[model samples]
Target: MKKFIMKKKKILIVLMLALLLASGCSTNDTKNNINKLEAENRLLQEKIKNLEKELNSYKKESKEKITIYYIKSTQNDFVLIPEVITIEPEPNMLKAALEKLIQDKRNPFPKDTRVIDVTVKDFIAYPNFSREITKLSVGSRGEELAVASIANTLIKFPGVEKVQILVEGQTVETLAGHVDTSKPLGRNETLISIE
Candidate 1:
């Protein structure tokens, strides 16, 4: 009977040891899982912070606004002339606005005589005013008057840093006998000076 009790005690001790080892192994697995999850969480937080910074920069850039100006001539019955003018809108919007202005019949200039090949790049207005020359009455002082009138008028637009007149896609010697059409024009507030 004593032998039987001794053998039973040995079996119980072995079972307890096995149970303890299993519990220890489970605790180690849980700890490893917790460490992996913590690392992943930290990485995600870093990514979120970087994304927030980029978003803030974009917002700041978006908040900046641009301004532009438009100029028109009184002698030509308030016709819009090509001159150094600042335009407030973006390039696409400026193109659309100019096109709208050209199409408006209420505009003073003759429909066919109007020049619409103007482009605004980097706040500089490139006015292809040479096309209007073909429509002008030949040998008439009207051509010179018209060039000056146009240049003087366009300088009124907002944000126009400068104006470059292109004749048939090339720079010309002069628009009339007075204003030098070779160089790009700066904003001239007074129309009389353009002559």
Candidate 2:
């Protein structure tokens, strides 16, 4: 009876050792699985970041087409010519048109002229310019054409019916002592040459 009891104890110890070894192997497998999952999660996060950057870059490179006016001198006189150009979109399209106009080399505005701001109310667009606008080096006809260039360009927009040119945010009497700019001007189709 004593020998039998000792043998039973030895068998119990061996069973416990086998269970412990099997559990240790299971724990190692679980750890390896967790590490692999963590690595895959990091890789997916990096791919998402890369996709977002690519989308932003594509948005920045996109451009739209708009028609801006430039002065074209004919045999006897000059007229505003419509020129379609590509520019980045702006929240205020009126301001964008004026800025594009100023950027053109053939535009009537004096060199160094800049657009301060543009506001629209009651179908009228008020474009305020820097003091450089007053320095136009043209005669009365040229001044008329310059004023028409602005008025005509803005009038092309759907909601704009007239334009009131301003110098430094105040209503100006005239641009270059020719055309009266104190009041809002309408689109002058006469100044535009379709050709």
Q: Per-residue CA lDDT of candidate 1, range 89-154, in tens? A: 454444444444444443333456545477767767777643655443323244444444444344
- Best candidate (score: TM-score): 2
Q: Best candidate, lDDT-wise?
A: 2
Model 2 alpha-carbon drift over 4 Å, by segment: 1-62
Query: Distance (Å) between predicted and true CA of 191, model 2?
Result: 1.1
lDDT of 1 at 148: 43
RMSD after CA superposition, every candidate: 9.7, 5.0
- For candidate 2, lDDT tens digit of each residue in 1-195? 999999999999999999999999989999999999999999999999999999888877886677888898899888889988777778888889989888788876777998999999999999999999999998998898888888988988889999999899899898898788999999888888888
lDDT of 1 at 84: 40
